[model samples]
Target: MREEGKSIDEAINIAGETRFLPVVLTSITAICGLIPIAMNPNPQIAPLAIVLIGGLISSTILSRIVTPVMYKLIPPQMDEKI
Candidate 1:
């Protein structure tokens, strides 16, 4: 929401604070699934593990780009008091 003068910390804090519980739960679920695949000996699970690993890495990278751009475009609420 840079357009409206919201800082990066404000946007991230707003997003994280609003969705904290659900995000944590989802992350936990993903980690649970990922752990099994990551530890599995089966060759078939190897690809799945690789895909998840790649996606996790890619998403981490892209978030740096996406968050700032999104903050610039969305124009966060001014009176929300984040």
Candidate 2:
């Protein structure tokens, strides 16, 4: 689609929508994985949870930053009659 000169919206719509699910899922998984560490009575999983949580937050922010840039970089489709 990028090679075909399709616009960001067009390519995105074609590919599904929003394209944020994977990012959202990853963030959720990270937070979930940290639960055991965060709530651990033994304190062994605390570091793991912290790292996962941090990564999830970073990824979410990065996604927000990158999505718009990607959309801008990709040109929209020109043939509306098709």
Candidate 3:
């Protein structure tokens, strides 16, 4: 979006909106895929699966909320010409 000359806020908004579906779908798919492993009676695999599920959930939530807010708060770096 910025490459197309959109302002920072517009770019951020557009990017966030554009990425929302894919991110959510991927996360949901991964979580669902991991469900059987997470429920496994194999202790080692089950714990790993549980951790991965939690990580996926936390990262998905944080990226959706924190990323946009941080982008808004931080100023974009400008290229310095000699």
TM-score for each model: 0.49, 0.56, 0.83
**Model 2 backbone overlap count:** 4
Residue-by-residue lDDT tens digits, candidate 1, 1-82 = 4456767778677765566566556655776678778888998887788688668656655665676578667755556556
lDDT of 3 by residue, 52-82 (tens): 9999999999999999989889867766658
- What is the per-residue lDDT of model 2 for residues 33-81, given as tens digits with 9 covering 90 to 100? 7787777776667776777788788878877767666767864555655
What are the lDDT figures for the candidates, one per model?
A: 0.68, 0.71, 0.91
> Which candidate number would show the highest lDDT if scored against the true structure?
3
Question: Cα-based RMSD of the predictions, in order?
Answer: 6.1, 5.5, 2.0
lDDT of 3 at 23: 99
Q: lDDT score, residue 30, model 1? A: 75
Measured by TM-score, the strongest candidate is 3
* Candidate 2, superposed: residue stretches over 4 Å from native: 8-16, 70-82
